[model samples]
Target: MREPVTELAGAGATTAEPLWRAATSARVRDLAWCTLAPPLLSAIPREFAALAEPGGAALASWPPGALAAWQRWLASADPDLLPPTIEELSALPGAVQALAPAARSLRLGRHAERLLHFALEHGEGIELVASNLPVRRHGPHGVQTLGELDFVWRDVARGGTGGAPQGQLVHWEMATKFYLLVEPEANVEAMAPDPCTRLQAFVGPNLVDRLGDKLSHILRRQLPLSRTTEAEALLGARVDRSEIYLLGWLFYRDGVMPAGLDALGLNPAHLRGWWSTLAQWAQRVEARSPGSPGSLDSPGSPGSLDSSGTSGTSGTSGTSGTSASASSVRWHRLPRARWLSPALVPEHETEPFETLHDALAARFAEPHRELAWRREAPVMVCEMEPAGASAPGWWRERSRGFVVPPGWEERARQRAVQPPRC
Candidate 1:
């Protein structure tokens, strides 16, 4: 496992403070690739790795955002367990089906970890040691605490030559982040080895949260060697090694891949989308076709997914000559939490553009309700085309965009203009 660069101790800094190092902006791209590749490669289109091996058949069904979310879950899951493709999900085993409803309901991050823990605990040939272990030491000044390790698992490595069994202990760290590319021209995008002047190329909505800070905090502070003593003592075993399991979704401008992104080492298949304010989304809906799908007074009944389970001829596939009129377009506002992966919208939950507009209007009319706008706000509009009768619950993106409060672009631009500061 590759380690992050270490920050040397400052004159009067405590051990933990000194461990708070930062990776150069360029490293973020490499780390992103490192963070993302395992999940992508491991995500064999619903455990169809053997089937998806040739001619990119697996890649066809695996969208970047969806695949990232799957792999993220698999990181801490049983190694032998496989992710099911959308098609396979239609007929899961009864045992899996029993858990499917709750599993499906979980947010992407938590869902993945939960499935992983279940798989590990139930699988054979390996023993589950511990999870989310906390370590602390009492100093004369006060109690000093190290953060939690996601898991401590013992790998039973069989000897190649039929020798004695070798059990290696590993302290695994896990995290998932979804960042949007804000400045494609920054040196960080180029993946330069030197420290980044600033953490502006890609960012979370808060602007302060970034790939650089996340990586630095993990590598420098979280996984430092100095803390190993306490970790091992708490676990009652010597740790052989530590590893970082990182996963992420890097969203780009919807419909348009910005210039210089290629230079940033971003996966070409990385997920992309657009954002706008609620008012803007309403305007777009009005311009396309007002009061679409014929009913907003009773938003309860829209369209239902045909029970056929076949990847039908219409909808996201766009085989129908619908031309994506507003009425033909199926839109949904993503849930505020865990909005990274393209939230797969079941056909039953989908309504017309008018439905969302009416729902938001009613929501805001509740008097005390507050609407907060942020770059990472949940006002994500997933513009999916209507699927024909055969493919139910399998909506595809005709186009996707985000709805931001006014002046978001200017704020992002202003941040981009400022030099990267160390």
Candidate 2:
């Protein structure tokens, strides 16, 4: 039985202040990862962690901003069971068909990003992040916390629309992966560890990369422990680990993420930047922490067997032509948010939508409606050429744009191919 803390007559001890304890804990944790910008990142306040876990949502579809708002609300709620009263928390699963808009996830419009270096440097595997994930990285004779890691795959970059009304990382997507977000970690792209210290760690013996005459260049530049990301694109300058693992896998293969992401209800913008962010973090964290020998005991490989269920074409596979060419990819289902009328004349208040964008709007415009809501699935397809690819080089750089595919034409003519829920 535990005894209540009755003060001993001779003892002069007192309970430590949470603020003081947190500060010291943060300082030590900071020193564990970086020395240059030792104070930039702040500890994820435990208070934020206190948000209520609204059980799982039994949603057929989610409204646009609903998921992000819920996640943010959860992240801000009590970490304990108690919530901010029902008025402040509603756990009802929203209907997938119609979701209302909500605030975008932002640390002042900033979002979590992957440490590309850590991911790119680490060997390969899909990073599986469990919310309130318990990442135990063994450090010098002890262990350290992989702070407040969100559920984006360790190797893939993930995010939603970021369109005018960007969709949040949907609640359902987590449902598909068992709420597990996976990414790669072996070919670290961020966390710049000391050269001497890295040599000491027992990793990188079975690296698949070939050795080169510029062996030193590859060693310093392309080795498994190297960290990398493009600094130009990181908006809001905040570090996020959402896609760290995804970047790792992408470095190995891009198909790993795109084909399967929509099933999780993630928007595309964040997904696009996963790799670049991982690179940035791997370099930065390594420069800071040096991940001393055991600080980074590559979280055991998930082995080939465990990866069986993950079909190569899961996230963005069906959405693009290149992806379509690889395998018969079926997109993780998304609620049908179709264009009822042809993409509205581009408002006609400004310059035309190049000719392709304008023609696409013109050619694809026609009223669409679900047939009695019976099998109301949104029709999607990929178009390889747009007005014959404006200029030749654009196709290679940005090959295809996701517009109404030719397949929709059949549905428009038939009308009943898809029925609306209401």
Candidate 3:
């Protein structure tokens, strides 16, 4: 959660504004924030704290002034300083077309990787040596792919100062993840007392991944890959350091802060969202509606609702006023590829809450190709409001959450207790 830098010199700004807020394009804003946002966890948990030290697996080496330059570039009004990729993206006629190149795949992780790749390729002070570099070895069966290196780069500004020598390479592993916290059931004693163990409470929406396991894999395996003999030969330069760029939102159950959160070493400024079963979400919305007994200002309410229970303005876009009632707030089901940023969508692309609910009901009630079993899958939904008079006919996301099917919580909890496959 670093403070936003003030507008660049000669830009005529006396106050600091968030970099994302300065960008005219939502996609570019997301890319800018992704490049500069702090890691989700402030530090490695105590269990793996030793790995963060020098000569350990997770040491980071950033070029001097690189972050500040990026921040300034993102916020600068000067067209000459803008990255070519961002400038071109900003000029696209439609949001979907602009995003299609980076979001070619549905995998959110891949989408994040593409965004970072674009930034590194076009931004200053860093030379991207290679990305998605595959490591392979001959096995008894045949050539086996060990793993892929996410990024290997050279810090153009390093070597002269106290930093590593000028030509040394740095390895970086990056991931964008979203997980919902599911507290353990009554059997608390069954789990270990280790602080890092609490990370299991954060599980992926599909229940196949956990934060603890992801961290363990990065520290034990991915970060060490660049130092291996095969990787060294392929790289032609010894990797002097390895780092991670882990970002994404963490959702809580109805916005409740669970206990022992300090043990997880979560970044205080990490992005957050709420989660609820479809029924629970509907109930909360109904309870917060105008004239309802439940107060709109109550703790753990779905999202920002004014005294009249209408949608509140989203600070990201500088839009103001209550343009829609609580019940009329538009919702768009976020496809996996579009989950990285606060969405900017055409008016026709969004639907009212009732329409969204009916669609979700149909989705859960019917069998589909993606679902192998009879169970239902959770869908991410974004609550959108008018983009104000500045961008009329466009809607922007004000808040987002996952609407899970019935019985999904119990299943997710069960998955949380099990060992992560990774």
Order of all candidates by lDDT, from best down to worst?
3, 1, 2
Clashing pairs in 3: none
lDDT of 2 by residue, 194-245 (tens): 2221211111111211111112222222221111122102121122221111
The per-model lDDT (C-alpha) reads 0.43, 0.20, 0.65
* Candidate 2 positional error at 17, Å: 58
Looking at model 3, how many pairs of residues clash?
A: 0
In model 2, how large is the Cα lDDT of residue 42? 20
- Backbone clashes for every candidate come to 17, 102, 0
| Model 3 quality (TM-score) | 0.77
lDDT of 3 at 110: 70
Tens digits of lDDT, candidate 1, 273-377: 434456755654565443334211011111111121111111121112233445556776665442433333455556777787666555444444253432234
**lDDT of candidate 3 over 286-400, digit per residue (tens):** 6555533322213123333333222222212112234455644677888765676566677788997778887887777766666633246788888776655545666766667
List CA RMSD, all candidates.
Answer: 16.9, 27.2, 7.2
Q: What is the lDDT of candidate 1?
A: 0.43
User: RMSD, model 2, all Cα superposed?
Assistant: 27.2
TM-score of each: 0.55, 0.16, 0.77
Error of 3 at 8 (Å): 17
